[model samples]
Structure formats: C-alpha cells, structure tokens
Target: MILNGITVGIILILIGLYGMIAKKHVFKIIFGLIIISTGLVLFFVSVGYVDTGAAPIVSGDTTYVDPLPHTLMLTTIVVEVCTTTLALVLALKIYEKYKTLDISTLEDL
Candidate 1:
C-alpha cells in the first residue's frame, strides 16, 4: 500500500505544521522541524520507487532503481541532521537567555 505511506507522510507533515504554528515551546518547535524534514525525506524517497527495481549497484540483471534521487535524499538527510543540531544549539541559547525554553517567556527578556 504505497498510498498508505503517502497518507502517513501527509499526516506527519500536518502534525508538524500544527506543532510549529500552535506550540510556544522552543523544544517542541525543533521536534516539529524534524518531523517535517522526515516527511519531506519520505516523500522524496518514494519518488524513486519502481515495482521491479534492483539495487543501485551494477548487477548482472538490469532495471536498477534511480540512484540520483536517493543520493539527493541522503544529502538532504545530512543537511537535516545538521539543521537539527543547530536548532538544538539555538534552543540551548534560548534557555540560557530567558532561563526557560518557552517562547512566551522570552517576550519579557
């Protein structure tokens, strides 16, 4: 059920969006960003699907899955990980600044 995967990705993306929009906590925003990145990665990886595709290696049999998108997805994931780390660092900075991770609390600072 490929459609099921799509639906799940969509749900995750929506939940992430809601968290990003509704939550006032800096930590939750970072997690929401991770969720959204995961959804996007899932969607991009799905595009390289083939019902009877083989691995990216040069096997004796042909019909290999496209390697381009998968490689790009890998790069994207690396960037996401770096972004997550940076977000965590920013959250830490926020905590140090206001003594609380809540965005609303930072308004007084």
Candidate 2:
C-alpha cells in the first residue's frame, strides 16, 4: 500500500510537471503546481508510514510510525496553501490587467 501511494504520488508529480511546462494558460500552470505540491505531501507521508505500526504515542514493543513526516507534512500543507493563495491572487490581478490568462497573450502585451 505504501509503495502504491508512492508510485501514485510520483505519477502525479510527473503529470503536474508536464502540465506546467506544456500548458499555456496561467490557471493550468497554477493547477499543475498545486498537483506537484500534493504529490510531494503524499510521497512524504507514505515514506514514513509503517504498515504494522501503531501511533507514535503508543507504548509497547510494537513498531511505531514516525511522527516527523507527519509534522513536516503539516508544515508543507500550510506553506502550500499560502503559496497557492498568493499565486492565485497574482494570477487574478494579471487577468484583470490583461483580460486573458494565456501566457503567450500576456507576453505580447
């Protein structure tokens, strides 16, 4: 399951990279960035997840899932949200000024 999640995350990241590079619309590029961030979060979480592990706070002889990845993911999510909001706001302003979201069109103006 963990490997599957990692594979999915990698696929998402690749798709996002392609979108960002090949798509001409600002919205699409932003969406791609969002996808990449999501993939990274997913990958990070999966890396630290243990199949037969208990919660980090649990006490016993059993394996425990590492808490660092979860903590890091929490921070990553917050930063991603803030950055995405900023990117969207900038994109909105760009659209308002140029009346179009196409990169080529914006470049012409």
Candidate 3:
C-alpha cells in the first residue's frame, strides 16, 4: 500500500483517459492528453529512480540511476509540447469555424 510516483502517474493516466472519453469539450480532451503525457513523464522518471544513487560519471562501484529513461522522458516532453501546441491550434480553428468547443456540437456539422 505504498504511494509512489509510478502509482500516481498511473492514476493520472487513467483519469486523463476517462476525461478524454467522457468529456465533450475539445479543450477538456486536450487537457486530458496533456495529463496523460505528464503521467508518462512521471512514470519514466520514477522508473529511473535509485536510492543513494550517484551521477552516471563514476569510477568506483556505485549505484547510478539509468540515464536512458530520463533522456527519453525529456524527448517525450518536447514532443508533448509540440503536440499540445498543434492540438490547441486545431481546437482554436475548430472554435473559429463553429463557435463552439463541444465535440458533440461539432459532430452534428
């Protein structure tokens, strides 16, 4: 019954999925996507966590956290930012065309 970053990330991902599926607002859906990405970042970072770990550059025998997950998460964050920006622009265009953020309303047209 331990609450860790991975657990929190999984919870966030689930919540985001629910929000995206259940909500009708385009902005809400976009926010859900952002939440999911954040969860993924958290999950990856937690996966690389090590207690009393030193920096990757070391000579002696010492525990070090894997740098790969952190590096990948950084790339993920950049991609997420780009994706979010594009999605927001598309949502803005949709609103401009339809004057509504509701997906159900947009679907009717």
lDDT of 2 at 1: 35
How close is every model to the real structure, measured as TM-score? 0.86, 0.90, 0.90
Q: For candidate 1, report its TM-score.
A: 0.86
* lDDT by residue (tens digit), candidate 3, 15-105: 9999989999999999999999999999888888888987677789999988889899989999999999999999989989989999898
Q: Name the candidate, 1 or 3, with the larger lDDT value.
A: 3
Tens-digit lDDT track of model 1 for 41-104: 7766667766688878996967987788789988989998999999999888877777898888
Question: What TM value does model 2 have?
Answer: 0.90
Q: How many backbone clashes does candidate 1 have?
A: 0
> Is candidate 1 or 3 superior in TM-score?
3
Q: Which stretches of candidate 2 lie over 4 Å from their true place?
A: 1-3
Evaluate residue 47 in candidate 3 and report its C-alpha lDDT on the 0 to 100 scale: 87
Error of 1 at 13 (Å): 2.1
lDDT of 2: 0.91
